[model samples]
Target: MVTRIAKCTCGQLQITVEGEPLGVGVCHCFACQSRTGSVFAALAAFGPGYRVTGRATDYVRTGDQGAKFRFRFCPVCGTNLFHTEEGEDNRSVGVAVGAFADPDFPPPRDSVYDCRRHRWVQLPEGITVYDKDPE
Candidate 1:
């Protein structure tokens, strides 16, 4: 089983996920950019086979489509570790790829919110692009 660990900057919070992610994606929406403090956010979605350790604070926000998402971050380091769709049971968790700090981690297979993507940002070749979240 392939295992990957993603953690906050201060190591106060961490998540260990077994096997590969369900999907990897990049988002250029304003909300994502703001949350990551970058031009885009790269994330990987994992199934329920994962373990989380340490203390975290939660912030819930409604998406453009009105779906609520709960973001969890380390209170000590303030690293947004992961997020999940609200009101879902055992749904896939979105983990910040940067938190893993692995250069060999898989690249994003899809890009969302292309309308907001910076003009200078060039996505990987053959990546699926979406103007907004795919339904």
Candidate 2:
């Protein structure tokens, strides 16, 4: 199994993910835009049990679909880290690519929320595009 390890700016926090990501994408929804403070939010989805170290601050918000999403960030530098479904039973986690210490991370496999994407943002060709999360 391939695993990637990431360390936060303070060096006190560590995140480790086993195996390649299940999926990678960017979200252009208003909520994602606001949370990321950018036109879109990029994420790498991983299976359950990925390990995260150090203390993280969490913020929970309800999506337009009424599903609750929880975001976890480094408390010190306020760097967005990962997001997860609200309930403890949920098994997937989405890690922010920007938080990776490696400079050679792969690009996203898809882009989502095109309906809310800015007119100036141009996505690469052939990648999957979705008005919202893929059905």
Top model by TM-score, which number?
1
Candidate 2 per-residue C-alpha lDDT over 78-126 given as tens digits, one digit per residue, 9 for 90 to 100: 7778888877575788888877866678778899889999989988777
The window of 10 residues in a row where model 1 has the poorest summed lDDT is 83-92
lDDT (0 to 1) per candidate: 0.95, 0.84
Tens digits of per-residue lDDT for model 1 on 1-135?
899999999998999998888999999999999999999999999999789999999999999999999999999989999999998787889999999999999999999999999999999999999999996
- Clashes, model 2: 0
Tell me how far candidate 1 lies from the true structure as C-alpha RMSD in angstroms. 0.8
Off by over 4 Å in 1: none
The global Cα lDDT (0 to 1) of model 1 is: 0.95
Which sections of candidate 2 miss by over 4 Å? 88-90
TM-score of each: 0.97, 0.89
